[model samples]
Each structure stands twice: as structure tokens, then as C-alpha cells.
Target: MSAAKIGDINLYEILGVEFEAEQADIRKAYRKKALECHPDKNPDNPKAAELFHELSRALEILTDISARSAYDKVLKAKKAAEVRTKQLDSKRQKLKADLEQREKDASYIQSYSTVPKTDEEVLQEQIERLRREGSKLLEEEQRLMREQLVRTMLEHQYAQAKTSCDSSAHRIKLKWKAEKDKSNGGYSYEDLTIFLKKYGEITALVMSKKMGSALVEFKTLEAAEMALTYEKGRLQNPLHLEWVSVPGVKVANETRGSILDYEDLVMRKLRQAEERQRLIAQMLAEDEAEG
Candidate 1:
């Protein structure tokens, strides 16, 4: 018989016999059906051809005792395996549902057990902690300031003699010479402007193109003396000042006049400030749109 014909029909049902029926009973049932549904008797009916083929295959297999017994055993094993698979699938589904329920219960318990802190409470706690830390920092800063003041007083006392005014003109020049000798004269006029801003006011200043030496005058002798005493020996570039007793010499020019124009620098700074404000406004607009 054809493989498709065998594949399409349940052989036991085609024979009209139980799966456990004897070979004789199977043969009897198949003969009766084969005669009833014979293609030769119903040549005009197309379905009679299919039923005849089924009956023939069923009779052929069932009539053979060995083939019938082997087929019965295979069918029994297949059915048993299908039942076992269904039981295993049921167990798996039940276990999965139980695990999911346990996880959900655990999540619910965790959510309810701890109440979330409010934004205000959290912010207040952070603020108080920061305040405590700031107070500690302030105490440390005050202590450091006191210590620094005491150290500065001691250094000032030690270096006091170098800054004293002398009676002899030659001795005063020698003192200025000694202070000048201690510095490295490599800094530009721009460097002096920064130094003056920090240390003392420059009352009168002059820079000569030929000598390249800067002459700076301070408001008081003490201010000039302080600059000569403290900054003279400390700077790598020699920034020295001689105590000229001349009068009516107030107008002075900066050494690097091209680089230190007040108008040009102020304009550049204002332009930068405007550009920064424009960028900040653009960022705020983007944030508002997103919100």
C-alpha cells in the first residue's frame, strides 16, 4: 500500500475492530467493510475509492499477527508518553504561577514596610549636615589665620633691619643695590602690574626704552619700603625701586603700554560677559521646553 494511504487512516477504526481485537475478528470486520465500500460497486462515487484503499491497508496489517502486535505496543507506549508529558507541563505551570505570586507578595511587603521620606525632610537633613561641616571648616580657617598672623609678625621682625631708612645717601644707595642684587631681572612690565595690584599702589611709574628699567613710586615711604623689603628678594624677576627724593614727578607711563590699555581690555571683558549671558538664557529656554 502507499505511505500516504497508510498515514491518512486509523487502521483499527478502518477495520471496525478494537485495537486489542484478534486477527480473525479484524479480518472479518475488514472483509465486510471492503465489500460495502468497494470501488468496483460504486465506480461513479469518488469517496468510495478512498474508503476501499483504507479497508485494504487495515486488513493487510491486522491479518499479519507479528505486525499487529508490534503496532499495538508502539501505540500503547505513545499514549502513555503523551499522558506523562501533559502531567509534567501541568506541574511546571503551577510552579511558575506559585513563584510569581511569592515574588509579587514580597514586592508588596517591601513597598509598604518602609514609608518614603518627603523631599523637605531629606533636604533639611542634608542642610543640617552641611551646616555642621561648614561650622567645622570655619573654626579650622580661623585657627589657620591666627597661626599665619603670628608667623608673619615673626618674619617681619627678622627682616625689619633691611627696610630701615639710612642717614647717608651712599648708604641708602648701597641698601637699594643690595636688594636689587638678590632678584632675577627677567619679568616684563605686565608682571609688575599684577605685583602692584597685590602688594602696594604705584604712585608714579616710568619705563625707559634705552635702559629697560621700571621706576615705580609708592604713596608713602612705608609702602615703598614694604615692597622693597618683602617683594624684592622673593621675586624671581628683579622689581627694584630707588627712593628718589625728587619732587613734581607724578605722571608716569607703563612699560608695556600696548598690552595694558584700560579701554580695550574693558570692552573685551564686557563682550565676553554678554556672550555668557546669552548662552545661559538659551539653556534656560531649552530646559523650560523639556519641562
Candidate 2:
């Protein structure tokens, strides 16, 4: 209670007793407050010892006639000072909040309302800058392709070397596009094992309603790879395989996408990017000649 932000809680407030309380009433309140704030009673509370000491001091001053009168005069002066301190804090906080609001308003106006003017040279520079940005994107895409290739090689090496299945993503999660028969819900673990054997060899197969699909762990990574290729149903089940590792596939289509389609997409994007670069170069050359 001698420390800052501690003794600010008035002695009367801490004891929760009225200012005009008699010695007997004050004594009773002190005992209750002391018991509640006692070091022995509150082992978890670090502030219990300080509060107990403060309670003892309050009781000592209030119990004695001379000490009580002296303490009352000091308490009255402290209360007046505390009130003034609180009023000033509140006023200062209000002024600080208003200043912050004004700064925020000024910042918003400066950011959105005011636009800087640029010359023809700046415009040409901006146009030229876009070509570098576009080239960077294309370069990033190439880097990604190289990384993907290296990753594929490393994954292939790891899969072939390891006898035990990949603990992380050994399982292939696939959802049925159509309604399944619930009558055959009484399937055992052994039955699931037998069912998954149709799609290459698997370590385990688990069906879950919560997952909304069947999770089948391939015996080898090659098996999982083969299963992924079967986007459309090869057999009667009509349930196309999708890897759990794939982020999104709420519902996989019955139709499969060919490698040719993927290649065509890459070609289209490359052509578009090249066309853009050609236009940019032409514009930059004309700007340089004019300048």
C-alpha cells in the first residue's frame, strides 16, 4: 500500500467500512478484511501481504482516540488531493483523445484528397516500370517451375527409398459425387481393407461421414500417384480419387482433365504475356524517340 497505484484505494474503501463507523464496527470490519487479504489465506495473491499490512495500519490508527483524530485530518486532505488528481487525469485524457482524432482526420485528408502532379517523363517512366514488374512476375513463375521440378525429383527419391509409408500424407481422401447406400454401413475394418485393394495396394482404408469421404493410405507413394491420375472413375464405383493434401476439392467432377488441356493453358498465358511485353517495348521506344 506504500507503493504507487496501491494506497490510492482509500483505507475505508479497502476495509469496506463507513467513515463514521464506531471502533467496535471498525474492528469487526478489519478482522473480516484482514482474513480475506491475509497472506496465509491467499497464497496465490502476491499483493495479499501488502494489503494485510495496510489493513493493520488502518485498524491501529482508527482504534486509538488521538491517532484516529490525527489520521482523519490527513485522510480528509488526501481525499481532496485524490479527487483533484482524478479530475485532471480525466481532462488530460480527453484533450489527448481529441488531439489524436484531429491528427487522424488530417492524415486521411492528406492521403486521399491530395494527388501529386507528374510530368510526361514520369508518365513514360511509370509505363516502363510496368514492363519490369511484368518481367519479374514471369521470372517468378519460371523460378516456381524449377522449384516444382526439383521437389518432384526429391519426393520421388524419398518415396522409393522409404519402406514405411509417409506418415504425413500417406492417405488419399476421396469423396463420392453421388448418394451412397447407408444399408451397408455395418462395414468392418477388414471390409474396408478389401474394398481399397481394387484401387492398387493400400496400407489402410477408413470411411468417415465427418470427412464426407473415404481415406485410403497407399502401400507405396507410386500407388497414391496412380490413384490421383484416375480423376474419373475407371471402375464401377464412380468415386474419383482426390488427395487429402490438395487444399480444395469440395466435389470432384466425373470428367478428367487431360495433360494437353494443361499445356494449352500454359501456352495461352505465355502468349498473352509476350504480347503485352511487345506492346510495352513499342511504346517505350516511341517515348524515347520523342524525348
Candidate 3:
């Protein structure tokens, strides 16, 4: 085997080591050489300047795991090529011997001979077989490549989502409270309308006299944060402010139900009507007793 040629003073030579040297040895070598060839110490020598640059490159590769792995692959391929050359020589010798033996036996054929398929037919069969094998291999390779691409995309998305969540500056929570006026019956639709006009938008209003509360969602954490801040001490007559951030606000209905439902307002009006009727009935009973 010919000795490996060294040309153009490269990183390995600048570090005074073989290409396959361990990282620790590379580092030690770099430190020694960097001190010796540092431009400040070797100001008069152009060669020292070149050597310093080469040492820098060597240290960069040695310190980086990925760069070192890539360089190692190159060395492995070179070694594999040498092994393949020896194997090819052995294969050629065996094939030559087999052909010679076949040629000698060619003359011992039987007199009764049957016609074989034409060369073109044999060639066509071989071509078809190869085509089928190639097609299967291509499909398998394509599937694997697609799977790798999908995994890469998912990793990218997860990284982006993580970054966004980490950088968020504010957090907001929603709170709900239910209030009733038994004397007036139920709450008024007019009051809710006036509230929504004053407030940005109503997120949700569910009315079952048994349960009355609004579920409001904000577009941004900042907006929600602001709303919770400003509305803390504010009160409208007959309605006081009580806020808490609780979980279990159904997200899907926030979009759909908000558009369709006016039930909360309607129920409030019904309750108020019931309260008014009760008061009127009581007054009439008192008047009849006096008469």
C-alpha cells in the first residue's frame, strides 16, 4: 500500500497528529502549536501566520461533535474502498476459473438436443425481473423519506410552539358570577344589552334561573388582562362586579353559541315579569281586605 500523501499543510499536520487522533490529544496539540505560532510571537514569519489559521481550523473541527463525526465518515469510506479492491480481485480470479471449466465441458453435450428460448426472450425476462425489484425498492425508499419529512415538520412545529409560549408576557383568567333579583323577578334583557354595548363583547350568557353567568373570552391575553384590571371596582346600578378566573369555559361554543343564543337575556326578562306579577297580586289582596 502506498503511503498517504500529505500536500498543502493542513489541519492535521498543523496540530502535529494523525487525522484519527483523539479529541484530548488534538486539544493538547492545538494548545502547544497555538502558543508557538501565535502571530504576536512570530511577527517576522509568514509561515507561522498560515500555521495559526490551520490550527484554528483543526481545533474548530475537533471541538465540534458534529463536524468530527462528518470527518470520521470520510476516513471510514477510504478504508472501505481499500477493502473492496481486495474483494474484487478475488472475485475476478474465481470467475475466470469457472469460465475455463465451463468451456472445457461444452463439448460433452448429448446428441439429442432441444431448442432453447432465444437470447431476446431471456433478456426480456431478466429485464422484467429487474424492473419489478427496482420498483419495490424505489417505493420503500420514498415511504421512508416521507416519514422522515413528516417527523422533521412535527419537530419544527413543536419548537415554534414552545418558543411562543415561553415568550408570552401576560396571562389572563376568566371568572363568572350569577346574580338574581327575586323582588323584581328576573334580570332584564335591556340591562344585558346596555352592558354589552358598554363592554367590548359578551363571550357567553347561559340562563337557567338555576344557573346564571356569563362566559367571556378575550382575543389576547393583554386584552383579557386589561378588562380584568379596569372592571375590578366598577359597578352599574342593580349589578355589582364579582370576578374570578375559573376553568371549564367550553372553547368551541364561544365561537358558535355566542352568535346564536339570547337565552340569558330572555330568561332575565321572564324572571322580572314573574316578580312584578307577584307584587301586584299581593297589593290587590290587601285592597280587597280593606274594602
Candidate 4:
């Protein structure tokens, strides 16, 4: 019976008979299976008819003496191959299952354990973030540092400037005599104070009348020069503005001037005026001679 290959599905297993079964045994098994799988008996099962045909074919092949002998050698080889295939298949499936289990175990261990960061990795992460964000952080830090340095330098320079201004010649005393006055009220302190405020910063005010003039002190040299040389400005009745020295008493009283200080101031001013007039007269004489 050169019907099928040796390694195909076993016919004995299909017929429910052992490999060592007798012909009578094969016949009995075949009859039982044919009845169970018959078209008339199992009308609802479509495969029943096909199974009946295959079983009948198997029975015919096995019951004949010559066919059975030929099939027995092939069947033995088929059984051995089947056994080897089943062993190899089982081992392969088991190895696949073990590999899957190992992967699952590794994943579980890694999920709970944290990877410690290396310095290079941390630096690399920072580099990546900086690439995305640009150099704004570095620029902001530099800007802040520059601002702080500027502020510190400005504060120091401001302090030095303030000290120099304080120590320098900001104060200048001014003496002025009225050219023509009714003596009723030639220069009132109130009017002078208000007028001076428009031009410069004034910290203190003093008026002295004992020296036949008013002695005034300004907080700034520019203010004293302005009051002395202004073309249209005057205290009252043709005021003669002159530079003088700062006196000991700050707020000089017009009605009660000290005797020694008043006399000295008067003499000094009179000498200065006479010397100035002499120089002017000499200059005028020289000019006329040249002409």
C-alpha cells in the first residue's frame, strides 16, 4: 500500500487502534468507528461522511496481509519521526515561553530601580535644554551683573561729588550800598529773598545795615556773581553790588550790628572802592593820551 507518505498523520491513531493490534481487532475497531461516524447515523455533522470514508480506506489497507506488511514499516518510520518532531516542537515552545518570562522579569526589575545619572549625562541634558531655550538665561545673568556693577559705581561717584561740592567755595558774601535811598525802606529782606530764589539755591539769608550798606551771603558763587553783575536787576534804588567776606555772625541784624565787625567791613570796602576808582582813572588817562 504505497498510498501516503510515512510522515503524514498516523492512520492507526485515526482508527483508534494500537500499532500491535491483530486483524480481528482492527476490523472490530473499524466497524465501531464507521458506525459512529456514518452519514445516516450523524446526519447533522458534515465531516462525518468524510471521516467514514477515510476510516473505511484505513480499514481496507490494514486488514489485507500484503498491504499491512508494507504499511507497517512505513508506519514505524512515521511514528519515530512524529515522536522526534513532537519533542523538538515542545522544546522550542518551552524556550519561547522562557524567553518571554525573562523579558517580563527584567522589565519588572527596571521599573522599580532608578538609573543613577553620570556627570556627562547631566551636562548633555543641560546642553539639549539650552539648545531648545537659547542663551537667554546666560544673557539675563550678565545683564543683572552689569546693572549691579553700574549701580555700585554710580553710588560711589555720587558720594564723592557730594563731598567735593560741600567742601568747595559755594558760599560768597556780598555787600551792596544804596546809591539813592529815602531811608524809609530801601531794600526789604522779603523782596530780596523772593527775587534771589528765581535765580539760584539759597540756604541762608542775612542783612546788615551798620556798615552803611547791606551785607548778604549766597549759597553759591554763581548766584553772588549774578546779583552783582546783572544789568537790569537791583535790590532797590541803584544798589552797588560788591564782593565781600563771610562774617562770623551768620544772621546779621540790621538794627544791631556789632561795632568791631561793622567798622572793619566799612574800612575794607572804602579802601577797595578807592583803589578801584584810582585804577579806572589811570586807565582812562592812558586811553586819552593814546587817542
Off by over 4 Å in 2: 1-9, 81-291
Q: Each candidate's lDDT (Cα)?
A: 0.48, 0.53, 0.45, 0.53
Write candidate 3's Cα lDDT for 25-64 as tens digits.
8767766666667666678998987776666655654455
> How do the residues 166-189 of candidate 1 rate in per-residue lDDT, one tens digit apiece?
111111110122223324244445
lDDT value, residue 233 of candidate 3: 23
Q: How many pairs of residues collide in each model?
A: 1, 0, 4, 0
| Model 2 lDDT tens row, 1-291 | 221222334667767789898877877787666655667557899998888767765665456555455455556666775676577777786886688699767766776555452232233343344334443432443355445544444444343333332322445665554334553333445645655666667765655543224566676566677667754442544555776554222111201334443343334434543543454455445535643
Name the regions of candidate 1 deviating beyond 4 angstroms: 1-9, 88-291
Better of 3 and 4 by TM-score: 4
Candidate 4 residue lDDT tens string, 127-205: 3444455544334433454454444444444444433332123333333454335542455677567766665766555
Give TM per candidate: 0.28, 0.27, 0.26, 0.28
Candidate number that wins on lDDT, 2 or 3: 2
Better of 1 and 2 by TM-score: 1
For candidate 2, report its TM-score.
0.27
